[model samples]
Target: MDLTNLSYEEGLKELESIIDSLETGELTLEESFNKFKKGVDLYKYLYEILNKVEGEIKIIMEDEEREEDFQLEG
Candidate 1:
């Protein structure tokens, strides 16, 4: 599965499903391992997306603060 295109929510849901499957112990060992790998990949993708969003938010907040400072000066 290509996780790169998935939204954070979608990746989280898929990760949850993988956890449920592992907890159920219904899958063969190899299958479970494969699922685990996929889950890890999804997690990394989600993490990267979160980091990008955080940086964007910081930039927006800084911009707002600068605008406020300018207004006070004016």
Candidate 2:
């Protein structure tokens, strides 16, 4: 599966797997570094997606309390 094309949940799961692999110290240094890089990329992608969604929600319901609403102007 292509990490870049994965949904938020899928990316997170893959990132968790990468973390497990790194923590186990079973992979060669190069492999570990590659996986780590991919994990970071996935994490960033997920975070950005989440931030955008949150922003959209805030925009959509500016007046109402959004569950545990906090000011999120962006």
Candidate 3:
């Protein structure tokens, strides 16, 4: 799966599918291990995306506040 191309919601859905598969207890040991690894990778990718979005939102909010302050001053 191309994590970079996936949105946060897609990543989350994939992660949930992985969890369901793991819970089924039907996979071979090797299959389970591979799925677990994939889940971890998906989790990390999602975390990074969330943090980046949060930072961008904070910056945008700060810019808006600065603009409002400037307008008030003027």
Among these predicted structures, which one has the highest lDDT?
3
C-alpha lDDT of all candidate models, in order: 0.93, 0.83, 0.96
TM value for model 1: 0.92
lDDT by residue (tens digit), candidate 3, 1-74: 68889989999999999999999999999999999999999999999998999999999999999999999999
Worst 10 residues of 3 by lDDT: 1-10
Clashes of 3: 0
Query: How large is the C-alpha RMSD of every model relative to the true structure?
Result: 0.9, 6.8, 1.0
Q: Where in model 3 is the C-alpha error above 4 Å?
A: none
Flag clash pairs in model 1.
none
Q: What lDDT is reached at residue 71 by model 2?
A: 50
Whole-model lDDT, model 3: 0.96
For model 2, the local distance difference test gives 0.83
lDDT of 2 by residue, 1-74 (tens): 36567788887888899999999989999999899888888888889999999999888776566533655542
Regions of candidate 2 where Cα sits further than 4 Å from its true position? 1-4, 63-74
